[model samples]
Target: MKRGVSAVFLDRDGTINVDYGYVYEKEKLQFIDGAVQGLKLLQAAGYKLIIVTNQSGIARGFFSIEQMEEFHKNMLDKLAEEGVVISRIYYCPHLNGCECRKPQLKLFYQAQKEFDLDFAKSYVIGDKLRDLALCEKEPVKGYLINAEKKIIAKDKNIIICNNLLSAAKDIVGFKNHESY
Candidate 1:
């Protein structure tokens, strides 16, 4: 995906931080090691850092939308301390039958409009299959974080990374690689 000047679509729960299932509390936010550094690397490489997450916690009544926003604000504030700036974060709070949900490509399209993203140049990273689903419809690449080795398929365009740090390395490589 060397199409240039594209965004990096990320899944929040497991990709950026630990997913404690409907995790909302700010204190519950445990960032994956190297998550911030990876984001920073992407940001420095001129890639837009956008988060596309599914937060069914709000729809499930486990948390409120306001609470989720506040938590995200806290997350942004924390990341800012480390010189990381997330361009935007999009989340779908639907349990079912929503086009904005992952695997639907709705949010990615929306992001394209607002962020001027080139899908062919973009990247998606997540712990689940839906995170990489956008790649199926677009020409970009996807990275599946196999922290547990639960995903056991050899996807052609999808790279398997041990963590976000490894994914960041590849992203940087892709950006700097001349033959990309």
Candidate 2:
């Protein structure tokens, strides 16, 4: 068996970038508040940063896969310039009915298979409930970014944070609290 590594499965749209709906243009790529600093903290904490996102714009005909890839490349390059390196990115381009969408374990399992992730110690940070669905099925911790203050976590293990930086701080033992 392969040795397991702890990873942080991040959601891209609203969690990292400004979700302006079906964002496929590289020029539209804008990181949310404190996203770069939060990612840097996670990286410094020795957690492999991986992006797990659901991009249904392809299926909806709003954007092509090539366009999305270009956007991702630009985002990666920007993050790299900020000293935040993403270990991998797994995206489900299918619509809601697909098995690889967020809340489904297919892409998550694929990421685990590729990296031999230690789910027990891993974490998920996203702006939506579906982004933290793995917490319902696995032992990993979940941080629901309540930047919009619209979500209320029902699960005990699912924490509520104002942004990615707060979640990263809590994960790195910089703070001890139920919510931030």
Candidate 3:
């Protein structure tokens, strides 16, 4: 089977770390259970791991962009220590209605151009429906974490999982099937 420019776009906050409002301090960052392992698995499976997050805290005056960068630097350093290297990190700092926010495909579009991604072969793993909804154009695959039940999108490409690791498995498995 053949895959396109496959990349795993991850949402931060609840999806990667425990959702604590405007988390800026490095000590405050906590990886959800199995997140590091899951990311390693995806990396081994040849998936480019990219982070697409919405951080309205910048607009809300909770944290500055500099603080966000510091947080991300700490995050990457920690992940690196655990043998996980994120290909890229993209964030939207605007408040609600921002074109780059979740439910909007702006960030995805940017990633597509920057990473040369094929939407059909890409997956967005997030904890919210809006993340899945944003990829409407190409009906990109999606994995929703911590969802009570499977998400029933008008398009059937989205899959819900218990956590980030499970979602990574689902994506890798789906690609494997396509290859076979």
In order, what lDDT does every prediction score?
0.85, 0.90, 0.83
lDDT of 1 by residue, 20-122 (tens): 7898998888898878878888887888899999998899999999999989999999999988888989999999998998888898888898877888788
Candidate 3 TM-score to native: 0.89
In terms of lDDT, the poorest run of 10 residues in model 2 is 171-180
Model 2 scores a C-alpha lDDT of 0.90
* Model 3 residue-pair collision total: 1
Q: What ranking emerges by lDDT with the best candidate at the front? A: 2, 1, 3
Q: 82 in model 3: Cα distance from truth in Å?
A: 1.3
Q: 1-180 in candidate 3: lDDT tens per residue? A: 644598888998888888878888888899999788789888888888999888889999999999999999999999999989998899999988778988888888898888888887778888888877656667578888887654465557777678988887777764442322
Misplaced by over 4 Å in model 3 are 1-4, 149-154, 174-180
Tell me the lDDT of candidate 3: 0.83
TM-score of every model versus the real structure:
0.91, 0.93, 0.89
Query: What's the CA error at residue 58 for candidate 2, in Å?
Result: 0.5
For model 1, state the Cα shift of residue 62 in Å: 0.4
Error of 3 at 28 (Å): 0.8
Whose lDDT is greatest here?
2
Best by TM-score: 2
